[model samples]
Target: MRILALALAGAVLGATSALANGDALVIGNSRYTAVQTLFGAQRVAQAASALNAKGFDVTLVQDADAADMRRAFGEFAELLDDDGGPVVILLTGAFVHSAGGSYLLPVTGNGRIDEAEVLMQGFPLDAALAILSAHQGRAFLVLGETGEDPDLSLYLNAGLGELDIPHGVTVIRGPAMDVARYAARDMARTGRFVRRAAIEYELQIEGYAPQGQVIVRAGDVAPPRGAIDPPLPDPFANRAADDVAWRLAQEADSAEGYQTYLDGFPGGVHVNAARQRLSALNAEPFYRERRAEEDLELDRNDRRAIQRALTILGHDTRGIDGVFGDGTRGAIRRWQEETGLRVSSYLDRDQIARLQAQSTRRAAELEEEEKRQQAERARQERVFWRRVEDRGEEAGFREYLQKYPEGRFADEARAVLKAIDAQRAEQAVGQDRRDWTKATQANSVAAYNAYLRDWPNGGFREEAKQRISQLQLDADRVRNSIEASREEKAMNLNFVARQLTERRLEQLGMKPGKVDGQFDENTRAALRRFQDARGLRVSGYLDEQTMVRLLAGGIIGIDR
Candidate 1:
């Protein structure tokens, strides 16, 4: 009886070793150091237990930092053997993406995830895809997205963006809660058809998944006699030929070269790497120009110099803050187009030097032109003063002062005009002086009209007519301003739109105070300045035309 019990123990231990079938890595991050915590992300840890039950080696981490996540990936990679089997990786947390690729972010970074941080710290989805590609038909990646849309900096966006899936890896993605439930219950179940489960859960499945594909089988089932299962082609069968072709392709390092290799050996071991390089080469049309600019390794001061040069050349880089954002890129593209160069929106070393030289030349030319204009203006002022001095009339002196208020003979011109006005006043009658004084004191259209009626052809007749004209114009302007205010109110812009308007005004250097969606005196002044600059109606209110120009196209529906 003791020998039989020992034999049973040995059999159990042997079966347990034989059942080890695959490797799995599950990382679920819920708490964050900077941004809002993703509440349901940590629940995805249940998937680790489910995968372990299916005879899979699982490594699970929760709320992992960058170093912790990297170590987990390395450990998981070491578990993979040459013999292909099922491979599963599940990641649930904040995600940010750019044109390059999607990234699974760790919980320890700042809220504003820039492109540099993403490349250095974030776990690239493409790297996971590359690893999965080696296993072909037996690879799976499940992504659970926390629907928190934090503001990622310039080139990054919040969410799992569009993916470039490899040839034979399957990807399943959904919201964090739904993905957690699906991963534990259906995805880890033995003998479950992944496609049917995905359909039932309403999850999005992408890349290479055929019908009836199962990750784990129920048990070993023998086939009937003479019924043969088709064998998958071995990835390393023609290693010598594949190696030579891959070497030639890498040496060429062109899209066409990679394409030739792919066409020759579709199932080769280096196929995944070749496809990744090919995709990157083809994705950006100006990849060479962009790479050339990046190779310069420009510092902040260098970027600011480029912006100053662009602005001096009248390209309007928006601001010279040393950040090459969309405005700077657009300015660069425009400058390149005008200078008869490639409009790639990226500047090489030679281009930067040329821009600096052109700006320096332009600055000198502008200075010289300004000096010439100043000399010419002085000569014209002298000639006009000579003509006015020869005439010596009140009208001539007034016209001379109107044209050049600070001319060389301005004090002489004003003295002579004042004396002429006093002599005219002395020549007028006592009652005429009294009536003109009354009209001037009242400073109204009716009062001026009364003064004109009392004394026709009086000394102040011209002055009274001018005053009436200005008063009438002022009345008309007041009516128009009131109508404009009503029109602005009718639009009924919401609080968020108001905030956006204020923010845009601030961006344009109008100095709208606070930007709290409250239209105060400062905000109105800013709106007026914006309107005045743009040649719109300067009523200190937002009309359709003002809104269009201020927002730089049209009123956008801002999310609250």
Candidate 2:
């Protein structure tokens, strides 16, 4: 167990402390009547001697009774008041666990260990833990043989296990479990390693076997990991952020030191006091600037503007009020540091002008950037317009304007629409001319009206309208004269037919409706009846075929 303990000791996770103020409370109670002698007194006395050799303030109690154990815990809690250091607890004895309560068996028992009387004389583990937890420090509880009691769930449930993170308490049953647990979280996170031979040599002094059945309940952050060799101290441990923060907060020195301290340990120990001193140191430069500015007739609002400007440049001036404070001075120094200017807290006239010039320069740069973007946009628009023009379609032109207005083909599309309209106008003019000439030749009122209606806006519309008006007035008289001419001709024909055609009609045994010579409506009807009887061409006029058929019928036809 001694060998295992030392082996585990070599790989302590938070082994940074010198433990200068560390107290070792080693208790060993072997003189028990109701239980087996656990030989715990010999083991823990050895552990106490080892701790004393390592410079720990050893508090040993061998074969302690119930009263003595209680007094030891009280002194332990008191000793922790002055120094917030590591507290090592070594317990080797018979432990009682019943009704979910844990206790350490005392040597001065009057009855059997199982009885309530003897149990009342034992020390409560929970009470000791409560007192220990009151102080702000690290605790390492090293337990001896368990016999059968597993009531160490008190420490297990307190987030104590193999994880290397800080905890209220850590339980180390033996050296193997302690070292193995440390090797897992630490080795997996950081790949630094230690030699196995060194660990074996360190732990061999305690006469422990190489047993490793360590159960770990390292909460949510722990991943399933294979075993790994223990590691040496981290190479960059001294320069770690926590270490630097701890150091800077502890020692507040120059103005820069305090500023650095605040940067590193904003919520660390003694940080509030460090910041207060830093604020005072920073005020020196701010006052100097204020007095100089006042003498130079500068308004206090200028400092406020400068603070705002510094804030824009990512420097934290804390606030933008006119009274420039330590925070503002520190921000000024930071701006100077970043800008490659001479590092100082005080701002002179030239320095303020240079700092203020950055804003002007940035504005000009942004304006130039915007103009460059506009030019690029126009260039892209031209390229897209050219591609759309290659398609040679109105739809492509319309779609292109949706993306890039006033495209290269926009003017050409207007020209195409104008050309189509002009060509259609010329074709309409030609069609109107042809229709008007046809109406003039026909000399009919209906044809002229049709031309006027179909081509209301046509090229010959005026002439068509005038001709239809004049032709309509004479149309009735012309129709009447034509009817008279047709009646006179029919009278002459009737006189001839009456002289020669009536007797032929009587011979054909067909009524010629009065046997009149004129081809009147009744005579025409009789001719149709006679033609039908003879299978001759039917006619209501004295056509050549009717004349031939009449002659063939042995009738004297009109020779004229």
Candidate 3:
């Protein structure tokens, strides 16, 4: 079966009395709360009649939830004896497997199966194998697999996984339809070789397989006393009916169509194909809607355009990239909600056109509003500039420049301010030069201080301060002129340094006697006059301070 593997071994003797009283548990679950219904799963319950006819006691459960399945399994276990008879279990429904083991899902299980949930709530295949292992050669397990592969979580996988069959327990497995039909018709037939029936129905057999193994013996097991078998039907008529039902089911191609075929012919040959179709049809609820959108054959550019339109309509698509990810899907859902369409998060041709039209209208409105705003701003700027021009003051021009540096009349305002600044600067420069002249004529520290107070930022401010400092030093030197002269004599000026000093003093309009290195009376008078004019001590002797001022025009070397 699509569920698990089975291997048959050991032969059962025709005289075995244990076959007279076999115990069988049949569970068929089709209606599920979470996943697609296995339409033919419930038909496996029909196998109970066959098991009973073969002198076997059977317990049947259909569309069972977790609790019901557990109760049924418990009751079936209680009926078994340690060494009584053959044991059979027929399970039909959805199954999931993981690394741990396989489980038979109850009707209440969801699509997102977890390991703990499966282990706790679902019936473990291991439990079934354990029960069958006790009966050994006479044990039979028939699993009806749905053959549906669903998307489960990481810890679980849909469908029956590989089986770890216990020795001596025979397992018969195939698609739900094949297993169901085999269980109903061939599983309990007297003198029927189980392996031959498995091969005929294309079911897989695993564990305890032998050349010839029969689960039921004709002589050992008789139909219950007073139980009369029904008259056999015409084989030809049955085939004709089966063929007609299958053809009609194929033509309808719907869940109901295939279900009808299943109800009428549970053991029909097309039962497997019909159940497969039914499972597929019920699996996808939005099949038609998804197909309609896909038929549009949207390319990347088309998807991007749709995203842009959705964004313009105030739906945040997260990005304008061509890929339609979760954000884009959410945006589509919102748009569909507003537009009174199915909230499938997918687009049909008409819906796309409507979205485009709405976005176009919105864009036009925004453009008009923007243009009106621009016109209003331009009007405000003109009004402000007119006020500034009327004032015609430097402060007004500056204020206008601060407000709108790139306004239309900004250049004209700048030019006018530049000319006005130039005129004021010329007047200020004239006053500054007159003040400097007065300060020099006075030639005192107080005069330089007055000049600084008037023009703190004047161009000659640094020079004025320096002269004031030099004058103060000269006054201090005059008070100690003898000691100052003694310091100068100690300098021991050479002929070249003395000659350079005399020449520098003459160049300053203070005529020394000659360019010779001797300090004559003419040289002394020139030195005293130069010192008096330049704010230096006027001792009429070549002191260190006087020599420094005299040689200010160039470099000089002296020994001290």
Task: Give all candidates' CA lDDT scores.
Answer: 0.68, 0.48, 0.67
Score residue 49 of candidate 2 by CA lDDT: 43
User: How well is each residue in 246-321 modelled by candidate 1, as lDDT tens digits?
Assistant: 6577545567987999999999756765675576568657767765775575644476678767766777665444
Model 2 Cα shift for residue 63 (angstroms): 1.6
For model 3, residues 1-560, the per-residue Cα lDDT tens digits are 00110101000111111226678777776535432333333245347656665656666666556777787788788777554568899888778898888888776535444556667888888989999988888898889776444447778887788989998998888667567767767887888998899867657898888977888877657443332644333334446667567656744545788899999999876665566557656776754555466557564447657866786677766544444555678999999999888898878899999998987777666446545765786688789888988888776777776555445687997798778655654656788878988998999999999999999987556557656766875676566567656655644444655776687778767888788988787877787766655445666676644543333333333211
Per-prediction TM-score: 0.37, 0.26, 0.38
Best by TM-score: 3
Off by over 4 Å in 2: 1-19, 34-37, 109-111, 134-137, 146-167, 174-560
- Name model 3 segments beyond 4 Å from true: 1-19, 31-42, 109-113, 223-560
> Runs in model 1 with CA error above 4 Å?
1-20, 31-42, 109-115, 220-560
State candidate 1's TM-score.
Answer: 0.37
Provide the clash count, candidate 2: 12
lDDT of 3: 0.67
Cα misplacement distance, residue 528 of candidate 3 (Å): 99
Specify the poorest-scoring 10-residue window by lDDT in model 3.
1-10
Superposing all C-alpha atoms, what RMSD in Å does each candidate have to the true structure?
A: 20.7, 48.6, 37.2
Error of 1 at 188 (Å): 1.1
lDDT of 2 by residue, 222-287 (tens): 232235633335554554665455344323334677577667667744364455445544644443
